[model samples]
Target: MFVVPKPLRLLAALLIVGTTSANEPIKLYMPDAPPLTLHHYVGGHGMVGDVVLTALARIGKLTHIVAEPWPRAQIRVAKGKDMLIIPLSRTPERENIYTWIAPIMELERAFFSLDEPVTSFAQARQRYRRVGVGMGTAQVGILQREGFSNEQIVQLKLGENPAHLLSLGRIDAWFTGIPEALYIWEASAYREQNLRQSPSLASTGLYLACSRDCDAQLVEQLRNAINQLEHEGVSLLLRQAYLPLQPDP
Candidate 1:
């Protein structure tokens, strides 16, 4: 009996099935971090969001993006098949957790202090009793790596204001990206709040991360699209809209 190999049979089946499954919209998730992801205030999303949308549109096909609070969005993207979260900080702790795409942007990881002055991460680690940060953010891991104990890290729930926490003397400082912090402060009364920018922890590149189970071919395609966008300055142009002007809060 002549036996057909399993791989050949699968190829034949796919060829017969065609590209209907491939046409399904790719689902994307993002947090409410401004400049990177402006959750629900304007233009559907912010700079990075606009960049991704433009790239995907130019690439064609997949066309859906969703914004959720970090905690819920992170969990969804990390486990959901083929789902992705954008402007994700590509950290050592997260390096292997998901499949990474091109760097959407570089963000300065910073510590913001209120009432008292903390100059650097070392000073903040040694002097501050508690540091507040949005949950499911790279800042949380960065702070943990700075030797902050679990109790020393204050996780701000979605929709809760870290600046408010700092102003109320709840947390000693806040750890987040420079643009994100500034965006929040500029759009809210927090600009004049006691919070002040402290020393930067590090400059980190943020990317779009797909679940591990995602198709590798699609990942590569998306990466190429973003690379083209960045190379051609479309991404930079999209980013320019948010500069100086307070992005839709």
Candidate 2:
């Protein structure tokens, strides 16, 4: 029989307690939304994904992660998978749909075009023959609210590939977030062939939306974790990756 010292026994007990406390691994879904969440050559990590994983780490063990299409991710959550979706915009309609947790990140919507220059939403509405939109996304809500009928909208999965359609003249403008839109626009082969994007159109906040199946106490714990991160400037720390826009001289 092996005999352990009192201090060793106490440490062993603490380790067991800690292990038991972190029994279940939390699932997190990250869609491919560049600069914010994208799979680059270096790795499958971005500012939003990184910040979210950091925050969630404080609350629970994160695992079983997948970077899929946003619509699929939404469906998974809707089906009550034990997971968290990052950078989701919370609307009154979505409130009943998903259990609310801490806000993970924020994003501003923008329009990228290959046709004539657009100074504003109204101008883009009138000038563009077609607009690229992500199916079942908050951007769809914005365009629908602005009176863009289904016939006028070209739906695509969530990501900057919509901008490619725009550049191909398949659509006029791609509706997307500022950081992502700009990154894709700059990187687009069409831009190399001469395509351009207008300035940002609108700004919106994004949040972490958990499955409604999540326990209330768990949700509250995650929210507190987020609050702590915010208080400690975790958001500001993440901002370091987003270098300000500097025009080519």
Candidate 3:
């Protein structure tokens, strides 16, 4: 019987593991949330998507991204096997639903209005009659926790422009991530002078997450790749490139 040397055995084992990881199919589900992710964006993926794609490339993994409504995407990714979701907020409500790989960005939630900004959630509840929030977003839970009623929370469908709704007096305010609000404002025909952003309501890390029963090796590979990108300042540069500069709220 021929025995392989220990060093040779180790090298072979590593190569086999690497080959398997590289061949594994990774499907990343995302919504059309601008700045963070937009299917039709110049890169065919926005900031978070860019960061995720870069990480996948570094790990020598091939992935297909599916664009779906936020609610549908979340459900699909959470239920699918070994799949991934991008730019997902790692909220307490969603903490255990998925296997969180790594945070790609920090998202600050805020209230945007055409009038004076409310100083606090308490103030917002008192002053605003109806607040617009994206359907299936963490913002909905945030507002509910802040004592907002179902009537006060208007769940807007995908492609519903909060700014447009605010301008038309449909919703008294829009509660959303700052980067997304700023990106929408820049792209819309709305005037910056008219839009008012409240002080940050909450801050959370947006992550690249896999399905609950994700492959351990795949998670490790992607996590290391993401950490490397963050260390190299690639994440920061991607954010800067996508998010527009605006005055402090």
Candidate 4:
């Protein structure tokens, strides 16, 4: 082996021992999108999905991507795997449960009714016949908080499939994020083709919550990277791209 200068040798040793601030590819979990997280037809992507992947790129991390249903993704993060869930709202229960780094995106929850108008959570709680909601979602918690019992709300695995039930008048209203409710409605091949989008009833911010058991250093690195990206204007660029496409009610 060739002899190396002392300074160069020291530099090489530091490079090997020092923690890099660069991004490392980590597994990410996202559920299918209809409204809240929609995949693009052109390249099989959605807004939240794009944000997760692109944010990793911004921080120079290798991105390992995965797509699964919401429940499964939740399970993965709960188990303390090397993963992150995106576009999730911040709630008290969640804070107690998971280690997350977000408010990644903002979302509004609302009702999509079949016959009568249900604007407020108060109205939905009192006048609704039957409501549909995604199981294990923040929307479900909201409806539960409004005093609707388990019997009144139909919990489905995915929010997109609820519109068919809504169209048949089997359910009175669908409780979901505005984007998802609209996605389901527009994708339906049934009645009420002229159904209109409703204004948001409640506004909540989404986040990239990770498991509490993950490496603290990794978590801080990501948080710092995301904050840096925000300061550097990457986050704003993304918002401008996706915000214009949101439904206007």
Candidate 5:
């Protein structure tokens, strides 16, 4: 029997590992959330997407982004193998469903109303007939946890503008991430109307997450890459470029 030298065996193992990593491309599911992840943005990917892409590049991992409705994107990623989802808010309800790789940014949810701002959930339930929130978003769960009834919560489908709904008096308040609310308000024709933002309802870290059974090695590599970006101030710079006036949380 012929025995391979230890150095030769180590070299062969390295070659095999490199080949596998280089060939396997991860699938990243993203929804169209402006200032975070969107197709029409200047870089063709928003702030969060850019951060994720930059991290993946640092790790030499190829990825293909799948643009889908928010609901479908979450479902597919939750069930699929080795799949990744971005800009996902980490909540107690979703804590066990996915492997949280890294926190991309902090998301502060609030109520944006054309009328008087609702500072508390109790006040909102008593005064507002309906509150608009994006379908399949963390805001929906947050409202539900706050004891908002079905009749009081209006789930806005993809492309449904809460600002427009507010103008038409469809929803009394829009419960959503502050960044998104500000972005929509600034761009919409409803700018003339005073958009009042209530105090933050909930705050959570948005993350790059993977399926429950994600590969541990991949998670470690991505996490390290993301940490390096954070250390170098790359993440902060990107965020500032998009949200210059956004207050630190």
Candidate 6:
């Protein structure tokens, strides 16, 4: 029988006893949606992003949060890269593609206009030819579903202020989440434009979506922490931080 060297035997024992485990920090990615995730905001981190960080602290795992364009973030998560993308709208087509955590918020999808009220989508189309939408947003699909054609849609950069386009008359209307519209409108040069939100076209849930490579146990732990926040009413209080920004309806 061949005898193994003593140091090699000790190394083997160490490998067996001290192998790298699943407790390392995970990388997280977020898009540039304010009041949620961004490079800069009223808070150094974003609103929901801060909440997520606090929740992760509860679980005591190091997590790195990254900010990139929304499309790139989606692609990273979709390709099964190990990352968590936040405020993703859960859709039927995306249901089975990723792991989901607690919903961060619900976005009311509706139209914001610069001119007279557009009570209906058809009326809006007749009154305004160019409508602005955020690039690669769920609102893109929602608008398409509402029968707005390519010619009528102007795809704007993610996190860009569409109120500018409407104020400049480059685009007559904008379709976006109520919070985002309100946030941008509050700061736009045309804050006095009196941009009105049409009746909610729809409301959708924005959640934390994890890549397939993200460990199931870690995901469960994060989900549990989020659930605890919700149960203890901390989540709602965090959300209420932005409630003061909503325009009177």
RMSD of each: 10.5, 8.1, 8.7, 9.5, 9.4, 11.3
| Estimated TM-score for each candidate | 0.82, 0.80, 0.88, 0.78, 0.87, 0.84
Stronger candidate by lDDT (1 vs 2): 1
Q: After superposition, how far is residue 49 of candidate 2 from its true place, in Å?
A: 0.8
What order do you get sorting by lDDT, best first? Answer: 3, 5, 1, 6, 2, 4
The runs of at least 3 residues in candidate 3 whose Cα sits more than 4 Å from the true structure, single-residue gaps closed, are: 1-24, 247-249
Q: Provide backbone clash counts, one per model.
A: 0, 0, 0, 11, 0, 0
Candidate 1 lDDT tens digits, 135-177: 8888888888877889888888778987677777888777878
Best by TM-score: 3
The most accurate candidate by lDDT is: 3
> What's model 3's lDDT at 112?
91
Across 1-249, the per-residue lDDT of candidate 6 in tens digits comes to 111111212222222211222465666777767655545554434556655655665666566666677788788887866677787889876788788877877878778876555777788767778889888788877778778889898889865668777887888888888777787688678887677778787788888889866777878887988887777766676666554365545
Model 3 poorest ten-residue lDDT run: 1-10
Q: In candidate 2, residue 102 scores what lDDT?
A: 70
Model 3: how far residue 228 lies from native, Å: 0.3
lDDT of each residue in 139-173, candidate 2, tens digit only:
88887777777867777865447656765678877
Which of 3 and 4 is ahead in lDDT? 3
Over 1-249, each residue of candidate 5 has an lDDT whose tens digit, in order, gives 111111212222232222224555788888888878866554436668777876776666777778888888888888888899999999898899999999999988888887767778889888888999999999888888889999999999989888898999989989988888887788889887778888987899999999998999989988988888798777776565566244222
* Model 5 misplacement above 4 A: 1-22, 244-249
Per-residue lDDT of candidate 4, residues 1-249 (tens digit):
111111212222232222323445576666666433543343323556544545554454555556677877787787866577776778776776678775566787777775555667787778786888887788877877778888888888753468788777788787778766665665568534555445677777788777767778767766776676566665555444434334434
Question: Clashing residue pairs, candidate 2?
Answer: none
